[model samples]
Target: MGEIWIIGATGRAGRNISAGLRAGGHRIVLVGRNAQRLAEAAATIEASGGVPPRTLVTDDPLAEIAAGRPDVVVNTVGPFGTTTVPTAQACVVAGSHYVDLANEFQPVRSLLEMDSAARAAGSTLVTGAGFGTLANEALVYELCAGRPSPIRVRVAAMPVVDGLGPAVLASVVDAAATGGLIYRDGRLVRTRLGAHLRRIPLPDGTTRATVAVPTGELEAALRGSGAGDVIATSSEVPTGRMARAALPIVGAILRVEALRRTVIRLIDRWQLTPPATPGEVSWAYASAEWEGGETRQAWLQTGEGYAFTSRVAAMVAARLAEGDARPGAFTPGALFGADLARSAGATITLDSTTKDLR
Candidate 1:
């Protein structure tokens, strides 16, 4: 069994992924800033009658990772904007595979851009191995398979998360600070934070409001479909007119370096209440259009967002540990094909006919 290290092992995502990997017979090392919390997290694994996990309490996880090269490292820390590059670089230096559940545009793009370095190091680096990027990017891959590069592609992430944590909120704040971005004629363009608001039709004959946001899904869609024009929207943001009008101003304020850091610090101490469950279904949608007006659409149906993210992250780590991935940087769907989503308990439906693609 491969030895896997989980950074931020005290966090919800980290704990879940650790349990999953351990159950799958891999040795786990729980790494975190808090010795007590890491011990507690390891205790849970031991209580499960699994191999007791090794706990490493350190303020500098990157340094530890570089020193003790595990087979794979799973990063559940955020805002990934700051953590992704340094952690992935540490993995490259240690010749260990890296995986993270990052879905921000900057972090995902930055990680993908390290393909040459990761390949040279003979280590794989995976970003966005989670609900938002994988769910939609998989559909984009499916829609564009065996077809010419599409002229336009639109993907929407509509995750229904059951709870919120301080880290998740911090990530949201980081994304808001990024404003809105879209690929137009194969170029990244910035716009208002809540621009391109649209209502997405669901498979259940309902419509949900979505607004364009700067997310990793946009970059993943662009790569998956080879589309010159790509837009990534999400139902996770506020969609009301007042909220939309205020988003740009809020984004502008958050762009200030000092203020953003202060806000994130405050968020770190927040005791957020878990949100009421949104239901059993979360959906991701993608549509692609060709130059001659031909179009294709697909939807991915899954359960709760966090659950799917944990599963996807664990699955990616397991595969990487098994040496199944090539030496490069990639998003999950790009590296493993669209079937990765299907294997992670998601069902894909295509077009108005609702043909099951699984």
Candidate 2:
């Protein structure tokens, strides 16, 4: 069995990932800062018929990772803007495979910048192994493969989750603080926080209003599709008229370092409940406009977001542990293939009448 270390093991995403790994027959080591919480997590896993993962309590996760030298390390901590770089660096030094569920543009871009280092170390470093990047990135990859680069591309992530935890909320705040970004003229460019509002079409012919956001998918879609202009949106973010008008003001407040931290702390203390499950199915949509005046669109349908994330992360970890990965930083769809999501209960659909991008 492969030996896997999951940092932030006591957190919701971490626990789910741990369970998925354990179910895949991997040996898990639950790593957390809190000893008591680590033990509790282990006990819960054990009660669910999984062998109790070895519990590691540590304030210094990097030291622990270097010491343990696990075959693979999965980081579930966020706001990934703060955690991804250091953790990836540690994994590179430790010569261990690295994977994270980062969805923010900064962290995803930062981790990808470590490709050279990771390759030199003969280690695989993968970022954005979650719904935030994977579903849309995969679609874009599929659409652009065996074709010329598209002139314009748009991707939207619409997740339906039962609930969210403090970490998810914090990550959103962190992204807001970073403000909106897009790929234009073959470069990352800035935009207003709530700009580019549109009603994105779903798999079942329905539509949801989406708002421009600085998500990892923006980078992923651009890189994967070789597109010059790309915009990433999300249904989770508010897209109403009032919300759009207020975004600039709210974004301004969040841009300050101290103010951002204070807002995050206040939000954490408030412990807001995330939007309720939108529906049984979550959809990720991608549309591309080719240079020749042709356009194509597609959708990837999956179960609730958290459950899908667990599967995606586990699958990537298992692949890496089995030596099915290359030495470099990559998004899951880039490292594996567009079909990776389908293996985890995802179904893809293209417009029946038009020339589909499949």
Candidate 3:
């Protein structure tokens, strides 16, 4: 297999993806800003019985990609709003397939806009390999497969993560700055942040409050299901009544570019991260309704959020390294089909009343 270079190799997602790729028998190249940290991660990989991945320490990851010219680049760095376009462009220039754990709508759409360039360069660019987008998008694709355009689609991501890194928190702040977004009437629509809130069902026979956020799953669900109205939400965001009520104000404050940058810097400087409470599983829910009233719903069940993300990213990167992907920019589901989620350790269960298209 071709060498896979993982940017941000010292981060949680990067390390997990490296381990996963190693387990799949793929050679890895760990790239990070700190040589000692990169070496530590490489040692962990070696301890796992995989060959020690080559390490590269560089302040400019894109420069490293351009110079080293790895066959595939798995970018786990964020906020993707700043990194996705530049890294993807570099991948195109380097004739390297690119994949990222981008969940924000802006970055996802930005990457898709590079489809022609990626195709021209004969490289594949995939976004939203993480649980925040993939599991829900995959469920939407399966629920609407073989059906005509759907009138409405709803997707909710509920990840159970052991912990979150400062980068994850920074990404969330960046996404909030983009304001509210959705797909409605076959077009992009904007709304007040947290304009829609609902209690969504889960695989464990329970319900959790979810608030509509501008997640990449909105775009992916719309593309996969051809739905006129789509709402992508997540339990990862604060969903309490007060939190919902304050979302618009918070969003407005962050929308200012300078303020957004300041908040992100503060988060980074403080090393702010979400709590790490282990959970048994993570779940994603999707429901689609056709114009004629035919409806289908599905629940995707998987293990912890980071582990699932690692597997998904590794699978996509390994496939691209093995020449198994097409030369275009795509979401994971649109590119490889929903079944890819199953191969990455996600279990899909359709509603009993929904038609069995499989």
Top candidate when judged by TM-score against the true structure: 1
Provide the TM-score for each candidate, comma-separated. Answer: 0.97, 0.96, 0.96
Q: Rate the local accuracy (lDDT) of all candidates.
A: 0.91, 0.88, 0.88
The 10 consecutive residues of candidate 3 with the worst lDDT sum are 349-358
Expressed as tens digits, the lDDT of each residue in 51-101 for candidate 2 is 678998899999887787888999998889989999999999999999999
Worst 10 residues of 2 by lDDT: 349-358
**Model 1, range 292-355, lDDT digits (tens) per residue?**
6777788999999999999999999999888797999999999999999999999999883332
Give the higher-lDDT candidate: 1 or 3. Answer: 1
In terms of lDDT, model 1 sits at 0.91
Supply every candidate's count of residue pairs whose N, Cα or C atoms clash at under 3 angstroms.
0, 0, 0
- Maximum-lDDT candidate: 1
Residue pairs with colliding backbones in model 3 are none
Give the candidates in order of lDDT, highest first.
1, 3, 2
Candidate 2 ranges with C-alpha deviation above 4 Å: 269-273, 352-358
* Candidate 3 per-residue lDDT over residues 1-358, each given as its tens digit: 7999999999999999998888889999999899999999999999989567889989998888889889999999989998999999999999999999999999999999999999999999999997878899889877777767778888998889988798888889888888888887989988878877888776677897788899999988888888788998888878777888899888899989898998889888998997764578888998887655577788999989888898899999999999898999999988998889999998999983454221
Clashing pairs in 2: none
lDDT of 3 at 311: 88
Cα-based lDDT at residue 268, candidate 3: 81
lDDT of 3 at 170: 84
